[model samples]
Target: MSCEETQEQVSLLIDAELEEPHQVALFRHLEGCCECRLFFDSMLRFSKAAKRDLEEIRLVADDILPLHGPLPVSVRAAGDGANSLPMHPSGLTGRRSHRRASEDAVGALPDRRSGWGWKRWTGLLAGGWRMPAPVAIGLALVLLVAGALVGTRISTIAGGGGPMGRDGRVVKPTVVVVCSLPEVQVLGSASRL
Candidate 1:
């Protein structure tokens, strides 16, 4: 690979994100090219320095951010009127802003009811993703009773009983057949024939 391509891949190499074959190619190029090797070493140092700085920042932030209360709102000057966007009250960047938004979200919900327990909860969550304890319990009971009834009916049916059986066992019915044949002609008179 060319020095330019190898230099471009420096960051990916430092981060261990380059695939194996490409990494081998880049390694070979870095070994051959003095300028690309220098570039790669410089980038490695820079990446390490950047990561160290970020860790320090995070350590300082962890110590500082929680000690301070919510930040004061910042107002922007309308230099170019079209570009005048108001600065948010959440400290400086995305992480702080997200934290601030989540903190405010609980108190920001609209309360519609006069009752205390339910209303307070609804006010905090906008009544999202909630099931009352009593309702949940009632539903559980309904399911339990339905399941029990179904189980009992299945047991009765599986015990060999038909619909007409009095006990839980099957009752077979009795069947009788009748047969008849044509009789020979009797004597014309009352005498024996």
Candidate 2:
């Protein structure tokens, strides 16, 4: 087989996906061709080195901070106060910790749980409680239906008139008829009437 084909087969063989017949052909070519043999060896070495490096990195990371357990008390305390940890020059570890700190600061307000007031209502809304999707949809539908009904009822009561009167009856607009004439003639006609 050509060197290019042999190289492709070598990759498939490394992945353990090459068929037995292709493997035998590749081995025969590798035995006859020195360049192909060197290519296959280098690929094997590179793969092994990469795997070894990954294992070393995983070990070092586990030693620094365990994956399963809680963080050290020092790390936890460092995140709690305004003082910055020595390891981190900035007072914040990440956006999440910063947000938590801000939330805690806001929650330090005076107690208002004893009475029903605007403060209590706002507190409930800010506490991250969420209405269920179905309930929210139902509420929207109810408001829409009620608004439509009220609008139609008011329009029917008012009819085509300008507006509803104090006694709930439609008030018709007044019609004015104007007659244009010379000023002296209009005065003379009014005097005759």
Candidate 3:
């Protein structure tokens, strides 16, 4: 291959990615081209220096390096930073601890021990302490309305034109009119009054 192409493939060749035949051809090209040789030497020197620099840098226990391997989940749990342990959106803790707090806030639900059965609670209640207060009050109000209607009907009948008997009881007009019908007589000529 050309000198430019040989230099371009040199880094890949050092990493052992190219086939054996291609590697031999590129190596022969590199030997003859001084410019390609200088470029390859500079790349090797830079890689060695980068490796040495990385090895010399000290990494803290909680520091998360971009290129390094991931820390274990348990190891993160023991560290101080968020990288060490799973944290909540609030930056305090995870969902498990939050769920526990909410559970504690709302107490446990009433169960069978409270004697509130599904069937009894769902049915229509007639009369009892367990009955809804609104329903009982509504029934009493209906009874009161009915009594008022009956009393009004009775008072209307008493106030209408009625006959008074000797005992001071008011008799119905229909009964008095029917009783006086037989007592009336038609006379042809009577003395002038």
Candidate 4:
């Protein structure tokens, strides 16, 4: 492989995404090419630095675990189990570590579907997805009722109450009216009437 191709492959190699043959070819190129080797080292350092920035350590378990021994009544009750670590310290005044520890717990459980309890539903809802079935049904029913009421109001405004038939279209009268004096009207009206 050329030095340019090998340099391009460096990131894929670091991420473990290169196939075996390509990996061997790229390694061979890297062995001979000084510029490509330096580029690969720079990329590795950049990736490590980026990872460190993105994954800053919140409170370590050790920091809060030792503090667990001095349990106030609220904190003790909140712990639920002796083995359970207080992800948040319960006291109002004591430790500002509460926020950091809780943040750590949140960071630890990143998957939306898995580790959360009731909070998973809250996250799903907060993500702007639809509500549950029953709630959606209830909303639909409300919308349907609202639509029907508005339809009635509009029909009343548009001079409704014509004889609406089974299919809901208006039944028009078949008879035709002729315009004239009563005696003159009889001339045309008699046959039609």
User: Top model by lDDT, which number?
Assistant: 2
Report the Cα lDDT for candidate 1: 0.53
lDDT of 4 by residue, 1-193 (tens): 7776787788788888888989888888888889998999898899999877654543333344444457787866544443333345443223435664566455542433445555555435334444554554554465556556556545754674445667777654232223231111211111211
Better of 3 and 4 by TM-score: 4
For residues 47-159, could you state the per-residue lDDT of candidate 3 as single tens digits? Answer: 89987676444222113332123567664443433223345444344323434434423642234233556435433333333445565456556555655655654575678
* Global lDDT of model 3: 0.53
Over 10-68, each residue of candidate 1 has an lDDT whose tens digit, in order, gives 77878778888888888888888999989888887888899889766765564355322
Q: Estimate, for each residue in 2-49, the C-alpha lDDT of model 2 and write its tens digit.
A: 999999999999999999989989999999999999999999999999
Local error of candidate 3 at residue 16 (angstroms): 2.4
Decreasing TM-score order of the candidates? 2, 1, 4, 3
Which has the greatest TM-score?
A: 2
Output the TM-score of candidate 1: 0.34
**Which regions of candidate 3 are displaced past 4 Å?**
59-193
lDDT of each: 0.53, 0.58, 0.53, 0.56
TM-score attained by model 2: 0.35
Candidate 1 segments exceeding 4 Å error: 67-193
- Clash totals in order: 0, 0, 1, 0
